[model samples]
Target chain A: MTVLVTGVGVVLPGGGRLADLGRTEAGSLEPVDPRSRINRRGLRYKDRATQLAFCAAEEALNDAGLYAPAAEAPVRAEIGIVVSSNFGNLDTVCRVTGTIGAEGTLAASPMDLPNASSNVIASSLAIRFGLAGANLMLCSGATSGLDALSWGRRLITAGRCRQVLVLGTEPDNETVREFTDTPRMLDGAVGVVLEDAGTAAARGAVPRLTLGTACRGGTLADCVAVLAAHGAPARWYPPEAVTADVLDGLFPGATRVDLAQVWGASSGALGVLQCAAAIGWFDGGGAGPVYAVTGGGRDSAAGHVFTAPPGVAR
Target chain B: MSAVIAGAGAVSSVGRSVDDIFTSLCGGRSGVGDLRVFDRTRYRAEHAYEMDDRPPGGPDVPLRTTRWLLAAIEQAARSGGLGDDLEGVPVLVGTGLRELRSVELRHRGAADIGPADLHFGPAVRERFGATEIHTLANACAASLSALALGADLLDAGEADAVVVAGTDMITESMFGLVERVSAVPPDRVRPFDRDRLGAVMGEGACAVVLRRSADARPALGVLRGVGINCDAYHVTAPSPAGMAAAMRQAYQRADRSPTETDLVMLHGTGTMLNDEAEATALTEVFGDRAGRPLMTAIKSMTGHTSGASGLLGLIVALRSLHTGAVPPTLGLENPVPEAAPLRIVTELVEGPSLSTAQINAFGFGGINAVAIVERAR
Candidate 1:
């Protein structure tokens, strides 16, 4: 049985709230409003990566309508949490290391230590939702996002979990500055609610895309070529290209508003843009086939392809 | 879905490969020696099984430990008679120190440790042209977690095969950290021994190629199941009850009863708390039947290889299954009084055709992993 993505969500460079970002169309980046939906207390406390994840997860759960009593039954003990990050709290690690090096171990704050762990995000999510099933935090540089999705699909297919929350979030780090000597780091998060297609359909859950095989490569060219050979229009987007490349790749000359100009570089946020793009096109009464590409260094890349629902484009 | 161990490799202080380590273990040799990799003159424990010579694969590549791991993988693949194109095969590498060399350089005020140190995954990816790479850093359980992830991936059909590798070498930064934790003994590792003080640090690398049973050669032992859990009890100290939950989960996944377990490759670090916890956990899971299972600790001879310990245990279990002789638990002259009345192998003991072996690894941050191996027909 193939695992399908029933719902998707994102929080990225453009906006804070799911609704605010949900209206985004693929064209150019847009400036985010400070008072947007993501300005909540708990959301504000989170680092950029955590913030993105929270937004994406919230949207996913909302779309699945899984926040009600039925989905929250006590006997539903098969919900698993799996998240992947390229750097895994690199920002917090840098802070703790600097503090320890300068002020000695005794002066280190207790709060900083827990936050520095790679599993902090997964642990926090587990605590939040009372998910006690298998939890894993995978770190494999850039490919971590796709790997997490692949693993989540496996868990669902293997009947280990009835529903799996798979999230991939990466925030800009000081390491980006230190190594690239450039300040162009993108911060965002993406999540997909994966469930067995038969089970999901029975539960009245609508799937946005039927996920296929996820593959990775050692080099960017190889990644693009392999994906393209698999019927995906894999194209490389330079840093300056922004969402223009994405919109062009997906719709060619289709009329759409470019939000990248206002949002800036989304980086890991491409997944978010794709979700928003799908929704925007659907809402705007214009669509056929839509494709999205998200890539990052550390060899991270995720691509999603889907077709519009019938009668929407007609 | 079962995954078979198609290939295995190692490079430790005992020897450069599995053959060398096994030969030395059969001869009852010890690899613990004075620490030479780093100047530990100021530290409390000055002994370690440091990898003295350049790893069997030519010159060191600055900060990347993946180079050594790749070498071991190459050896394992050659032994397993596998192909060079690891495309579409998942690569999971485990390590206690992701970039220890980078840490050392930063401590010494080096401006940059180069791209090699900054990006460790790409180094391995470039070498073998892997389709995917997953790096895990869970202290001691890193490699075991990698094995578990491999099993999960295979069961998920993410790949036809997976390469799980664990590697850790003694570094100045790691030496300092161990000294601070005070887990290192002044002498050698004496696991489960009454007078055991602490663990002896060591350096090594081990890799195993795993494939679905259908794709695996009939000769290789099958990786039956893998169980992993977080204790969430303590950071450094294990649950006094040991990893009962984790072990139960493992046995349940393996579909085996406690009495069916033929042997146990313990994660005996020789520390007082570690020994006590392991014994307690074993007793709880097996009850009176626990004492019937043949138990041994290999760290007394190989020293504690941190992330690589669990993989070494797997290698030892495979060798034991092959030879039908369980290796003795060296440095365990006087067993702890509180330990279970299990038949501890104090000397190399010839045994019946062993069908099942469990390898256990508990890491810092309360990470615990158990891997079950079944002898192939």
Candidate 2:
């Protein structure tokens, strides 16, 4: 029941073109037309969030090497899609509700109603890929994306699904304009494929070289203590903990990679960016356990322990 | 420890309590009527199922939806026979079409939208004194998904008890969307009926408490199994294949055949497409046994509560088990040919004490979820 991360896909700020996460400059999300990247027709109805998730899902599935139909004619593995977002479908909400509030309900666009759902982005991906398993969306806050990844692992380990496409999506919107105007918001989508260890090996896909840890119902200090027990994490990717400088005092020498430095401290897609960057660095031969922690409005923190597993060629 | 339903509560267009909704539904009462919450003269479909009792939020308080949610959650927690102090427990809330009323009020210069009231998680955290909260917005099936996730957490020994809730409010956008798509009934919602035109828009909130079976005292119903999947067929249309797969998955997870189940609570949105597709899915899953298990639809009276719809149906199932009689599916005078053979409970059907019942919740974006509840052993 060991759940392993096999592949990942990321769509970050600066228009989905990533020369490198570490070196990339932080800025608001640049325009990336999903129509050009999606290669599908009839996408005009879909919102930008859905399109971004679709684009990222495609890349992650391709990286996983298990996108082929599993014996069935067209049905894929009962792979579920779990998406996390703080401001999902806000643009659609603002536009639709605004129109209705102004000119009455008759003025609202019917097409916009469905797009204002937090889960539509996930369902959009499922419809395209034929993934007819459990579809869930977590809409807590910043750490929800990390919660989604941990929950994806649990879903696979519990035998609910053989595979799961875990995504964290946030599109540019006016709802959090002031926050983004400052330095705590970014928009885009990031995805990862979680699969069984045996399945990943059989598919000849190099697993996301690593180990990971998940714990719920703990304070910030407790979270760091739990991570401390696992042996001081080599590199840090802490989002909520950044408000407090205790991490530096605890593990001063560990190279702390500030995601805000790369993603403008935006809570929306920052954690996912941190995750993608950590995995990218791991895949690129960065050594030791890559620390990733996120805790937002909720009391508990979600932590991940990543290291290249022994004898696995990635 | 197994996840079990210890208590339940709901506030639909029909009634404010689980007993009120289920009893009214059992007695054949229709809640659909003219919309009084707002002006409906501009819309084609003027009638709707609106909440009679308004939550307390005038020019002073912001986020009317949060008030409704808190009321329903408090009611559910109390009715679950548990004490009021639910501090530090994990909370997962499924919400639909949020912030419309607040935004409208702000637009009208009536009240300023407070920061604490904007996010559902923080609102619930502050109101209930909860440390952890998660909001799920997956359309009508959100509550069922949240319940499924809570069950998973309980099964994994993550929490001793969890509160899963769903809430939605009747907004201009919701009603307008149905009218725009021509998915609104002219007068009343006739679920699975021959003359059923479309679904009627309605809104409400529902909450349920689940605790580890080993820990829950005097549990009412046990969470037997759950199966959730995306139709992947279309966003708004139902997929027979996906629906059948989900039903099959649920029964398999329960380690029992469909025949073993006693009753079914249907999504039955009253739309022609939804009813026919649901009938087709039942036939595909049950085969010759399609007509065996007695099924009932509550949406005829409850209307479609969007994200909160499934939990209202869950409450109905619990009441059926408790009363030992199935609630009647009002407005179902003539059954569709696709569902003729199946026992669509249009009348108050008396049977053996309900042992198990399955609830189906489907929504836009092809989101499908099934949850099985069984009488505690």
Candidate 3:
């Protein structure tokens, strides 16, 4: 029941290429105006995180050949979605709550209230894409991104959907910065389309990478151990919170790629961004069996093992 | 491999424990009352199912969803005869609004709610000593989804025992949104009622300890199967087709027919669209057997507990199986015409031998989750 990662899309700062994930810093990049990239018809009421997600999802869906812009694509009930974000709609929620606190409860607009829902970002993607499958929004602390991936995998493995869209988005704004303790937060979204092997093969979609073994627990060490049971990783993308010395003790001799140094604080988007980085590394002719682990703070961590598929340019 | 409910705990407006809530429901006691949690003078609707008593928690746990969650989990563990230390047990928390009330309090300088508190994983680990934690924000269907995931984890041998919980508190933000949306707020929640105005919000927390049926522990009930789906239709609207699809999926997974279900706990938000959609979905799924299952809507008594409502409904369903009586759906003076094909339990119906029950939880964003549970043989 192996799931294939057929598409990778990112709305990172500075228009960074996915191939240059760990090789370069994201720089002092600003958020991209999603208005230029996506349709503006339904963008007015969408929160920033959701807008970024739409941008990433469009690219990922197109890359997977499942969707095309203005192509009158048939609605797919077999495509599900899983979203991971801790502060996706913080600004919208704060605005609504602030309005109620300052002016009366009646002051908050009903139109903007839907955006205040924690699952708004995930739901918005489902609505725009006509994906009627299982939709879940995970805010499971530091490992949320990986948690989302796990759910996506489950959906496919359980035969609930043939392909699942997994997005990890965290919006950077004044409200999020004020409420969030994580420094250098990622300002955009990262999306990866996970398809069942049979479906991908039938559609002739080339896999960017194949998911190996993935596990999560209260700490990074626990997840690493679970994945390590399969095989030791050649390269490891450790969370920014984890220092090289600690990772050296955990996975000795493995090349450590600190993603936070490249793309700010990943927060909830850590796991998907890590997988995207792994795809980039593999595309760069890196070796197989890479481990990407997110979470080192007080919350739980998730480690996923991925390998370049056969004939993936070696 | 089957997953059984080892223990259950709850804190609703009518009662604190599962038994108390069941008794209150059987007696048709409504938890709806004055909305004193916030100033109600400014809003058209002034009543909600607000909790009168606060549960104690560790200093690290804030006093909103986290505190209630911890209390519910602790009660669940104790009732299941577990020791003080949960050790390696994994904890899953589901919520529509995860600690937004605490965030609002922090905004008003009333409390110091940190970013970590927003996600219940760290707090769950700290208080329960559980190494693995997952927080799901699937809106109203969250808790049932958690239950489904928990069962999956057990079936996958990920954990020997898992605790799944859901909690939400009435926030001024949500109240404001409901107020603005409702044309006229109903004095009380009246699910399936023809004259039902709209739903009133409630605050509560509920938890269930789940273990493999092979554990040989005394169980409250068995989770037969769960089906989840997203309508993708509208943000605020429910789809009858989507809801029926979920029920069919659940029945398929359970390997049980719709006719086997003896009771059904309706999502029944009392909204015009929600009630109509649910009734239509039930009719579509059950067909001529629509009137066979004894249907009850607990929201009429518990008000809409939001994320916690699903687990709360589940607890009531399990209690009904044990007590051989279905709780009444209060305020159902006139059944909606759409629900005529379906049998609505308006009064406490006793002396019915029940074995299987279905619980429906539909949330904003068109998220629908249906779980089927059967009595432990």
Candidate 4:
């Protein structure tokens, strides 16, 4: 089955559209007050992670022109929701626990419990959009984004759903001070509309990119070998361009793209930014097939092969 | 392309071994007890099913849940005839929402993700050298979601063998959330009982090893089919349509009718809305053929283990298939009449052989999951 990336929504520390986000000199996108981008009414109870994800979902749905299922025929069953985040709302958990511990259980805000889990973003999106499809919350730490997308693709191929909105939502909380302080950890939310090629073309939506096979649980060597086995291209597109002396041998003379330079280190959302970068490369007059490896400096490794959409003008 | 559950293990308040847990269930056991770790004098719903014994494993095993996981995996490997060497098997684990106790401190320091997420799946990957690891945090129904994914991976030939595990520990935050939500019952867990107040929050871990039927030998049960859906109606409330649709999809995938199912291991959280919605879903799926499959609520005894609740339910179902006895839904003497045409097994029944069973797991985020289990042919 041919799965096409129909639309994308990205919010990084760097300010730019998905296509223009790659400029090295571009600073990270600044945080907009959650109230500024979205309505505050139902937004008061939600955490920043949930708020960011909602913004991205709305943007992607609008981009895909599939924001409203009730408006169209062939009734859109709830869209499958898959989100990847590692401790998306650690602060909420802490505050809820601390508040209850200090005060009484009744004193704690009831709203915190619902948004405390990582899946809160996805579920909130579901309720916001009235999506009733299969929902999943993947927390593979750094590799969460790719794993999330992988699961979304699995849902579509397994005939479980026709389209899935795969998303990565991470917030910069004081609880994650260490990760944020780290050299490459940029915090943000990114989303994409993954639909069947037939579905996209039916709506006259042009495909932005095509996600290929994704594999996990492998070492770097193991990841490289598996990608090689899958006939993945020797060319590489990493979050950072400069390669270490050792990893250079994995993909000889591979042209590298530095996505983190502009977007910063977004953790699991890095995979989303990488996908956007790949789409940008092709959409900006580059060729097909970009191999990006996530979780290089973290736990586990996943290799995703994405190709430019067919027949898109250079 | 079928997925066979080769081996399974669990660590609960009753026991660590799956066989022992099954035995205890058959003998009419209640794992619910007092919460020991924290001072619960000020809190409501002080009782819960908790593991008092320390996690049994090497001192090197890092966290509380990680130790339980390693022990369960070892047992699963041994029972499944897969041996200790799991060279290429993929591991997927489902844990609770996040760390409940140390969420504040763990974050104030280095950007360490919470201890729960870090210590579980990553530990499995590092200790066992697992190439692939997936950590699902879909709240209570997460384990079932992982099981569904593992089955799909096995069927797609993407994995030769897959291990699916779910673990959660009782935490003050979780307890607070349970209390705040008014989900904890006044006294004991009494599923399908008219006098039932709410559910008792429980804690534990369960693991199951799965392989393609062609490759697996001496399998415990075949995971015939799995269906999952979200209510999208509310984050905390169950949607009857979503629940029924998921069960219907499971039966459709397995090409079997729900009426023919021998037994059903319900999520039966013992909460008001969950039980009511579940009963409605049951009626929607098995309309005229009601009062057929015996309904058993294991949470009435085990308490709700959150994410691991589904796997725990599956454990009970497998035991029922093995022994000719079905465990009674403890604490359910006065059954609710509204869920009529559905027979609640309030008493232990033996010799009523069952070859097929179903497990229903509904999470807080309106996630509904159902898995069909069948006796290996």
> Candidate 3, what DockQ?
0.69
Full-model lDDT for every candidate = 0.64, 0.73, 0.84, 0.75
CA error at residue B217 for candidate 2, angstroms: 3.2
Taking all chains together, the TM-score of candidate 2 against the true structure is 0.92
In candidate 3, which residue pairs get closer than 3 Å at backbone N, Cα or C atoms, i.e. clash?
none
Query: B129-218 in candidate 2: lDDT tens per residue?
Result: 776677777788888888888888888887888999988876655666777777444577777898898888777888998888544357
Candidate 2: residue pairs that collide: A184-A266, A185-A266, A211-A305, B7-B80
**Among all candidates shown, the one with the greatest lDDT:** 3
What TM-score does chain A reach in every model?
A: 0.71, 0.89, 0.94, 0.87
List model 3 lDDT by residue over A1-314, tens digit each: 87989988988877765865867556758768898887787788788889899998998898888775422554567889999999887776778777876676668788876776788888888878888888889998778887788889988887778899999998888877788765567888989999878889888998888988877666777887887787778888887667767777877778888777777777889899888888888888888789888886788677888899756655
- Return the lDDT, model 3, position A259: 78
Q: Kindly indicate the candidate among 3 and 4 with the higher TM-score.
A: 3
Model 1 CAPRI rating: incorrect
Using DockQ as the measure, which candidate wins? 3
The DockQ-based CAPRI class assigned to model 4 is medium
TM-score winner between 1 and 4, please give it.
4
Model 3, TM vs. native: 0.95
Regions of model 2 farther than 4 Å from truth: A15-19, A27-29, A68-73, A175-185, A217-219, A240-250, A265-268, A298-301, A309-314, B55-62, B79-82, B98-111, B114-119, B183-185, B214-216
